[model samples]
Target: MSSEKIIQKIGQLYHQKLLMLVKDVSLVLVVVVAIVESVVRLLVVVVVVVVVVVVVVVVVVVVVVVVYSSSSKVVVVVVVVVVVVVVVVVVVVVVVI
Candidate 1:
């Protein structure tokens, strides 16, 4: 056989041997990676949920924490109402994402 063809045959045979040796290991690696990816995705979802809940709770606490002046009662009411509504909308959007 020509040198080039002989080299090509050797490469093919070497590849076959390498594949036979690593097939099982390659499968295991794929499975492990998939599981790790799934776990990471779950953790991300959980973190997002926790953050949204904390934001809502903090906003609610702010309404209780601030002592408003009587003159600015209407403004305070409007601000507080606006903040709460914004928070709710943000939570919804974040959760959907």
Candidate 2:
């Protein structure tokens, strides 16, 4: 009977240790899941910022091209007008003199 009690006590101790191991494993799993979630969120934010910056750069490039082309056209028109006015003034002065 004394040996029987010793065996039962040993069995109980083994069961307690198993429960503790399971609890530790579960805690470690929860921490790992949290870390993974944080990493995913950070990656998502980075992707969004990159996309926004790319779009802004494209828009600015397009606007600059359009504005520069239109400004070039205006410069050409002004040059032609100035040449015509100068020719007219020279002819008028020759006739008057």
Candidate 3:
């Protein structure tokens, strides 16, 4: 029948349109997923770099404190020794004269 043929053709065209819409949706989904993955990767790299910089700064601060403390102790010892030597010499000279 002519009506039957027209109905069949219309059904085929509808099916084809549905397939095309599905393909377009799939392509859009893939692009969205790729964009999300890239953003996550970038955030991870930024976090890692920030952590490493913080660790390095802490290490440097600790090293500076240790070095300054040791040097200050050495300076105190040297000053004490010099004062003792000068006092002893002055006392000896006063006694001899």
TM-score of each: 0.51, 0.62, 0.63
- CA lDDT for candidate 3: 0.71
Worst 10 residues of 1 by lDDT: 62-71
**Candidate number achieving the greatest lDDT relative to the actual structure:** 1
Candidate 2, residue 95: the lDDT equals: 50
lDDT of 1 by residue, 6-71 (tens): 999999999999998799789999999999999988887887777668777766665654544355
Q: Which stretches of candidate 3 lie over 4 Å from their true place?
A: 70-97
Residue 22, candidate 1: C-alpha displacement in angstroms? 0.5
For residues 38-89, could you state the per-residue lDDT of candidate 2 as single tens digits? 9977876676566556555655655566567768776566556555655665
TM-score of model 2 (CA atoms): 0.62
